[model samples]
Target chain A: MKKVGIVTGGTTKFTKTDISIESLLVSAIKQIFDNSSNLSQKDVDVVLTSTNANNKYLANITSELSGMAPKIAHSVESLCNSGTNCIVSAYAYISSGLADVALVAGAEKTDSPGLVLDWDKSRGQYKHPIYWSSMFTSAHKRKFGTTLEDLAYVGANNHRNALDTPYAYFEKPFSVEEIMESKPLTENLRLLDCSMPCNGSAAILLASENVIKNFCEQPIWMTGIGQKAISASFTKNDDLTSMKSTILSASDAYKMSKKAAEDIDAAELHDAFSICEIIELEDLGLVPKGEGGSYVRRLYDTKDRKINPRGGLIGTGHPLGATGIAQTIEICQQLQGKAGKRQIDGAKTGLIHNMSAAATSSTVLILES
Target chain B: MNKFEQELRNGNFVCGECSKCNKLVWPPSDLCNNCFNNVKWRPISKIAKLVEFSSKNDEYFCIAEFENQIRVMGKVENILNLHVGQTLTLVKCGFDGKEIFVFGLGD
Candidate 1:
């Protein structure tokens, strides 16, 4: 298999304004062309679109709109991690000698049908994401003594980090007190603790090591990738305190990359809710189990941007399909020293964690400069 | 509607049990996940143990496990104190586009 590297990427501002999925996708794609001086319509060999909208032939449509006639074109949808899933598909194409240059684009509308997993009958009347999140919170609180204040700190820190991210949906920062005082969605959840669904798009260009120099000067190599799907049903996650999929996926990712959690200079965690970040920190081996709350609180107090520096899904606004790609882009920028305000200095390695469907499925990627 | 949804709409909670492996296939599949053999539909027990719970607008929602395998999220009623591992009875259940479960403390 050939080495695959991210060549260039672009993103559109995440917002709640009504926008066509195709339009949002094109806006992000146009940035790739604008960013890469050598990139042209004829250079793209594959076009993969990640989205949850019911639109048909989206990859072909976006390919034409972007003036590309790739040999391979299709769509990939895996709920919140669709963007990275599509990128992985492109990586496969490039690594297998099937394609050299692949363009991956992801977009989501505010009212995307992907928000709710209607197929999980186990969720029953409590099908909304908050219910599962609440369950995770409740269990974490019961077992680890995680408190509402700890949950609030996750929100406040992420929102504070988002203040520096231009493309993030949230512009203003919220105090811990403000987040704690927000409208209660459940006994363990608050409105501020949740990630808002919004309209957004992100795109990335990938190239094998052979032709990467043509598209980018300092390409970020995709060193490790791991994905796991235990079950689609929410009830399958018996251990509510931790995300089983995330733990398993991260283990594989670390093993594949030959790097431990300490080597990861920064990471973009899938904080769909506050409890998610706390659990992911432990599950990913970045922190000890049951110590995630204190770790995050310490990060918050010290103004550290080591985790979710670009603002995680909670602060960045979850566009579902576009989120993973946006996260990958942030890591790429951080590694390249292009991330202005939120850049973790001298970061040589980065990680991306994206999950879907109540933590039943997860994808972890390790990237290096 | 499949057997599970059909039975649920009729106020019956049923799960797919494999005849060969005797393993309960959750989410109601046509084939057993363990043996790939055909499954038989049967009613699930109403006695469930609380797994986790949280309240929304004064209405309690929780995950209840039955038969030590099948688990689901539903509404809890007539119980002031909720704790994990507490036994509860499935008082009423129905499927109205979405599955609805009402659990109460056992008398």
Candidate 2:
């Protein structure tokens, strides 16, 4: 694959703001230009928007708002992983020689529709994600003897990490005791165990290797990329404890990058739920199967592994469409040594894992400084 | 209502059996997920084993595995000292005018 690099990136605060999706996209786009040295809106060759908002012409609308007239413009939607999907699409456009520079922006409102669990009729009243997440938690506990304390550590650790992240929604760190005693949203999931929905936007400027010379001085190269989709309904999946999509997508990415799990110095995983981060850790090969709880406990005890240095979705707030893009930007900042107080020292390689809809689809990207 | 919901309304638990691979398909699909062949609906045994379960607002919801490797999600009634891998049997189908399958502890 042709080498593509992220020239510049930007993100809005992940909070419950009353900003329209259009304004949010424009803000994120302007931030990218403001951060870059020589990049301009007119230099863009393609513009892609990742959103679930009702706006149909988001691609065109973003261009008009940002004052850009790109050759290609469109929107990409795949639930929470929409942001990563847009980046992957932009990567393709740059690699295929179809475009020299691509701008991928993702924005979502807190009240965006279509997030409800009404697609499956068999679920009836039990269609909500809380039920599915509860099932995963119970199954993991039954299989691995994972306790509630282990899950609480994940929530607390991510929350603490978010204290230093400027764009994080929940900056107040909660102790493990507080997380365990928080209000229960489901059988085993507490209020702190779930990622809150909020309004946010993220933008990334991808440039081909040739364009990087003139556009960016220090670009973060996107080394490997992989994506996969599985069954949307939870019942169709074979194992309730692990997501097959993550496993397969991570494998593809590892093969492309010629790097193993141990080679990655930092990672930004989708922690839509506390258990999700643990399960993704195992499925992505960062930790052995059935050892995710222990791994998280170690991170909590020592603060060594730089997982979710930007506080993950739990601490950063899950803005659905913008989440994957925000995660990618976090990894980029980590690799660039620009992550302020949360920076993981000597971080050269990083990974981003984003998934959607009960882990039915996923995208994995490997980035190197 | 769909065929699966209609079947539940008539007090029958039916699943699509792949005509080619004989794999049981859940969520009532038109084509076999494994072989991409046509599917034929057939009645399945009411007996199932509890795979996993959780409670919310004192109501228990569970995933149960039946014959032909078919797994279904529904509400469980008469929730006693329930545990994973316990035997469960379909007690009734549809609740509150919706196709909500209900199961109970099996003897």
Task: Give DockQ per model, in order.
Answer: 0.93, 0.55
* Model 2 regions more than 4 Å off: A122-124, B9-12, B17-23, B32-40, B95-99
Give a tens-digit lDDT track for model 1, residues B30-101.
899999999999999999999999999999999999999899999999899898999999999999889999
Docking class of 1: high
lDDT values for all models: 0.94, 0.87
Report the error of model 1 at residue A322, Å: 0.4
Q: Candidate 1 — which pairs collide?
A: none
DockQ of 1: 0.93
Q: What stretches of model 1 exceed 4 Å from their correct place? A: none
Which 10 successive residues of model 2 chain A have the least lDDT summed? A114-123
Instruction: Find the candidate with the highest DockQ and give its number.
Output: 1
Residue range A1-369, candidate 1, lDDT tens digits: 999999879999999999899999999999999999998999999999999999999999999988889999999999988988898899999999999999999999999999999989999998899999999999999999999999899999999999999999999999999999999988888999999999999999999999999978999999999999999999999799999999999999999889999999999999999999999999999999999999999999999999999879889999998999999999999999999999899999999999999999999999999
* Cα lDDT of model 2 by residue, A234-338, tens digit: 776568899899999999999999999999999999988899999999999999999999999999899764899988999889888899999999899888889
